[model samples]
Target: MPSAPSVRSPLLDRFGRVHTDLRLSLTDRCNLRCAYCMPAEGLDWLPRTELLTDDEVVRLVRIGTMRLGITEVRLTGGEPLLRRGLPGLVARLSALTPAPELSLTTNGIGLARCATALREAGLSRLNVSLDTLRPERFAEITRRDRLADVLEGLRAARAAGLAPVKVNAVPVRGVNDDEIPDLVAFAVEHGYRMRFIESMPLDAQGAWDRDRMVTAEEILDRIGERFALTPIGREGNAPAEEWWIEGTDSVVGVIASVTRPFCGTCDRVRITADGQLRNCLFATEESDLRGLLRGGADDAAIEAAWRASMAGKGPGHAIDSAGFRRPARPMSAIGG
Candidate 1:
């Protein structure tokens, strides 16, 4: 028997979780070929006709924020920077009457050129994926030699007044695990927040092994050796468990999605670049919002579609359950 839904909103799930954060993937094309993310070559890009136009994105954001009470919206991508007219899209989203807070997650390769513009267009913050600080290791991990470009982009993001600039690193065991200390040092030196994430099963190659993951405890134990860590009580629905380094005011966070999943408190929903609504990152099924949009459906119809999809969200992603299977699409296709 399920509990009653929230009278205040329709976004509330059966478990009483109110979905507020929306991760919208702007594109499914990336410039780099990270080994864990996608293949080195021969990837088929989504047809331009299928992608949601900037106007379409703005329309959905309006419906989400105004009708559904979504409070925060994070723009993501294969690489969001790859999308044209993105700042304009940001401006439109920021103009909503009760505009939801807007942020972006990027590979940081193109920020150096557009960080100032993005900030001016009303992007509030940024999370850049930076797996390794070593130039050689960076090249090895991403299969790209643009580490210096990414570093410059991080600096540009900070200089452009993007508050709380954070770096997200997915440290694999025996891959970039040894560079955690150095990565921490780099983040501290640059006054950026650092978040270490346990590698998930979203890899393109489908070769992820649970035993190979560097668990949250392992990350904390390793970093604790260099700096005294004081755990900070995480706020509601935040996936990361943050800590403050003793003596240094800088903070670090670990998103232990694999070891200790936060699906119970997850307040997020994702919309793929192709306009599919996903209730969970590892959701086996998707609801097609594109059909509603393209079929001349009204706002009410779109909202109804959203509510219907979210109503079916399960207790968790079931990654730890027996006979668990990975989603058909990889992280790049699913939007990180």
Candidate 2:
């Protein structure tokens, strides 16, 4: 017999933020070695046994939507496409009562191979990481010559009918900073929304310097050189500050995570591939959901733990404060 629906309060923090978005990581394994995310040789991956089983992922997500008020779910990863049985997992996630909106973030290396299957399986949207359009620059940044594969994956994703296929690019000062205009142009031409993110302090190398990051102001200036920009005010807790390019219906967004923090309105929580619950992206502490799930705890216990974890979420990431510290895990391991 089917279980009755759970009636519980929404996931709210002491700061009065209601968490409605969940960023769930399926695996800590990735195919690319992006310069900003990982070292040339990637870090050690979690053992397969340590990862949350597909059944476990569904149960937790079910608790989130049915018990809590989570309405949106984005599957992240070192690269989510690397997860086996991805389409089947998406199908299960989509079948939940009050089914949350499903999205995926990927480097788009082999997305061409599975885009249609993923769309048919209930993926609602996609965000592809593409730093540069130049093949040589792409190879230099990623340490792999897979630019062609990524481009093809973008096209395949669009053809698969994924609307608003967002392209996420990080403009490193000495690397792809000069290509900002080109990147925006390409996105506008391709019917994809372009998002330029400031290089954050999440790399495995811990070499992030504020001076090397391309600021949001500078990004808008670069785009202004080629096209006039009209500010499109942000809606809700969205991290991106968007702008409309004159003469076209295309829009571009900038995530100034460092210079312009948006923590006051943050409404998202994360679950690592190994089942650690994080209230914030830069949170130092994690609540052990994996232990609870494996220890035979009931749904009520898991719900209590999840809510308790969010209660301790700090006011903000505090990247600019002197007391700020980077997370122990890098971006790749932390699911981007």
TM-scores for every predicted model: 0.96, 0.98
TM-score of model 2 (CA atoms):
0.98
Model 1, residue 78: what's the lDDT? 91
Q: lDDT of all the models against the reference? A: 0.88, 0.92
Candidate 1's TM-score reads 0.96
List, residue by residue over 1-336, the lDDT tens digit for candidate 2.
Answer: 224556868789999999999999999998888888888989899999999999999999999999999999999998999999999999999999879999999999999999999999999999999999999989999999999999999999999998889999999999999999999999999999999999899998888888889999999999999989999978678889999999999999999998999999999999999999999999999999999999988888889899999999999999989999899988777775
What is the alpha-carbon lDDT for the whole of candidate 1? 0.88
Worst lDDT run of 10 residues, candidate 2, spans 1-10
Best by lDDT: 2
User: Model 1: runs farther than 4 Å from truth?
Assistant: 1-10
Worst 10 residues of 1 by lDDT: 1-10
Candidate 2: C-alpha lDDT? 0.92
lDDT of 1 at 129: 96
